[model samples]
Target: MTTALHLAKSDDLPKLSALVAAFHAESGIEISDEARTNGLAPLLNGIPHGAAYLLGPARAPVGYVIVSFGWSVEFGGMDGFVDELYLRPAVRGRGIATEVLLALPKALAEAGMKAIHLEVAADNATAQSLYERTGFRTRDGYRLMTRVL
Candidate 1:
């Protein structure tokens, strides 16, 4: 089925949250309900400096993408992070994701964003391929390291 993407509204939070939780579970990442409740709620509601979108038919939201904005000197201006991008497993293999990635940058650019970025699991070849096809290249000199707060 072909799905269209739209700016996510507050009413779509429950479905978006479920999809996020499922993605977390499938990836072995533990996401607390409190985080979803307290954190995501505000972000999706426009209380934060970011945006989220839902992708699916008009009747339902089957996937979502969350983006956060930031300054990037390297990119010469504002940049964005694709904090999340997910399509239900049943909807994979179709070109929906590719189309989304292809279209998103134009929208972001029009909003004054200079670049967009996303992190994928090193072993996720499928995701890597999709990203590469969309013009994302691995930075040769950088390693992503993080410490939990």
Candidate 2:
């Protein structure tokens, strides 16, 4: 499937929110509506901290991707974390996500991002395999650890 990505704008909030809510519910993530709004609003409003992209079509996107930026001396410069990526159930396994994964990194790299990262559930072998094919690899002796503030 050939799809395009649109950088989400503030006006796209309602559509983005609906898609995010669907993704969260499907993935068993339990976040409140307010939290979701708080997180997505900044990205949509052109905050340098991150960006949200609507996949497929602006009017009715098939999926969405959220990428957050951070300075990483270890990586020699800016790095991006793919905070969220989701495709509607009807679109999964059609290479749409793979295309995004492949294309997004190159775009980021061109924009001076040194590296990109994403976390997948340990048991989700299918996702891991796809990520690997798209050039992601497990780092030996390192694990992602996070604490909510």
Candidate 3:
């Protein structure tokens, strides 16, 4: 039932980092708090490269989402990638994510974001189907390639 995405602030870092830690652990990502803090602090401090949002009450968020901005000549303007999304296990399948996915991108688009993109595990059909419901189409013949610097 939680559908609001409160933009994060520097003062919220401790709580937000805990949520990110939980999400990373659940996803099998081995990350240190120092690393997490380093990454999140800039965004929270208004660095413009990305953003994080608490999904639900600001004091007791049920989940969080991170979005990183980009520019695409192909898309003709600014775009964004859903860098990460996480919901507490107790809250899955209740259509909270569905509501967020459906509403967030539209809100972003209205704010002049040309497009929003997300990556799903090739095997996570449920997530894929969920994203597809929100009008995210798989780019035919294209796979996301990345190099970690």
Strongest candidate by TM-score: 2
CA deviation > 4 Å runs, candidate 3? none
- Residue-wise lDDT of candidate 2 within 1-149, one digit each (tens)? 36798999999999999999999999899999999999999998889999999999779999999999999999999999999999999989889999999999999999999999999999999999999999999999999999988
Residues 5-102 of candidate 1 have per-residue lDDT tens digits of 78877787788888888878887878698787676787767865788888887457778888988999998999999998988899898888998898
Clashing pairs in 1: none
Against the hidden reference, what TM-scores do the models get? 0.92, 0.97, 0.96
RMSD of model 2 against the true structure: 1.1
Better of 1 and 2 by lDDT: 2
* Candidate 3 lDDT by residue in tens digits, 1-149: 34888999999898889889998998899988899999999999999899998898889988988999999999989999999999999989988889888888888889889989999999999999999987999999999999999
Best candidate, lDDT-wise?
2
Which should have the higher lDDT, number 1 or number 3? 3
Count of clashes, each model? 0, 0, 0
Ranking by TM-score: 2, 3, 1
